[model samples]
Target: MSAPRGWRPAELVADRFETASARTLRLRVADWPGHLPGQHIDVRLTAPDGYHAERSYSLAAPFDGEFVEITVQRVTDGEVSGYLVDGLPVGASIEIRGPVGGWFVWDPARPAPAVLVAGGSGIVPIAAMLRARRKAMADSPFRVVYVLRDPGSLFYRDELADEEIFLAYTRAAPPGDPRLPGRLTLEELREHTLPPGPEVTCYVCGPTGFVEATAAQLVSLGHAPGAVRTERFG
Candidate 1:
């Protein structure tokens, strides 16, 4: 439960996507320590006069080794994502503290049946959980339902295309896509048929409104309240 050692950002590299909305930043730190999947790191920026701002971003890469990968989605007025997407460059340094947070982490040693619900940028941490699951060969049962506006805006498309995975689009449709279209509704969730018992753990993350609505729907569909765990990002 202790905070992972903090490190200074030692380098930054840009990864441009076909869509301008998504970009991956590879951050290198000086003596960066390892972190469990689903843990997040804090990035802090300061003004010339030393006034500061910070944000917590989940690690997107697998937990195999050194360096951390954080995939950031630009928010309209977000200081961190705005700078990370448009201004920060390789070799730029910043103050970072983490791997912080405990409630959302997915430990390989204790994998359990999991249901992950992500909306938009909320997929960051869930992606890391998947990586850890794959690496550890954890027998934890898994199902992910990622709700996004459209296919073009999806964070990790190909990596989550398994039959067990479901993508619910609330906005535009994906061509030739057979998955459901529209927001995730309580009825739809019930139709999907979750782990059919009380043993499943549901993890939901997204904007505040989405998390609340989804958690409500899950509970309404007979999922035990104690079995549902959530994290919200504004």
Candidate 2:
């Protein structure tokens, strides 16, 4: 329950474009305290004139004392995201704070089934949870419902795939796909998501509207209200 560590200089050691509009940055911080799956950090960029632009970004990978990874989706007029996604290159130093947030995290050791739902770029944190779950070799099963505008827009598109994840396309389904092109509906949610039960832990992250609807649907499907944890973005 203690506060996360303060801002420290983080050097971008590597970066790659995930999509035309999004990029992932690999930062090497001097003294990272390590982080849990689904936690986030505060990134600050200052202009030469002392103007500050700060934003919160979810950790895109699991914790293991390696370099920290944060995925950024360019916001139309967002100063920080714009810089991170398009301008930041290797060796750039940025001020980063905490591996923050406690309630919305996943602990691999916990004996519970995890139902993860992500919308748009919200997959960043859930991707971390998935990585941790895979690396931990835990027995707990994980099922994911990832909603994206299209296949090309998926972050970590190759790593997280079918068999465990149900990719839902809202704007357009991949060529010849049967799934309709629309936002995730409660019907689709119930069909693709787990059968709600007391032992299942649900984590839904996305834009505000997506988070609200998914959480509500999970509750309506018989899961405990307390078991559904959510984080909203944008």
- Candidate 1 lDDT at 217 equals 88
Pairs clashing within candidate 2: none
Candidate 2 on 87-195: residue-level lDDT in tens? 8878889999888999999977674788999999999999998888778877787889999998789888667753378889989888888888998888888888778
Candidate 2, residue 138: how far the Cα is off, in Å: 1.5
Off by over 4 Å in 2: none
Best by lDDT: 2
Off by over 4 Å in 1: 5-7, 13-18, 196-198
TM match of model 2 to true structure: 0.95
So what's the TM-score on candidate 1? 0.89
- What is the Å distance of residue 146 in model 1 from its true position? 0.6
Error of model 1, residue 129, in angstroms: 0.7
Model 2, global lDDT: 0.87
Q: TM-scores across all candidates?
A: 0.89, 0.95
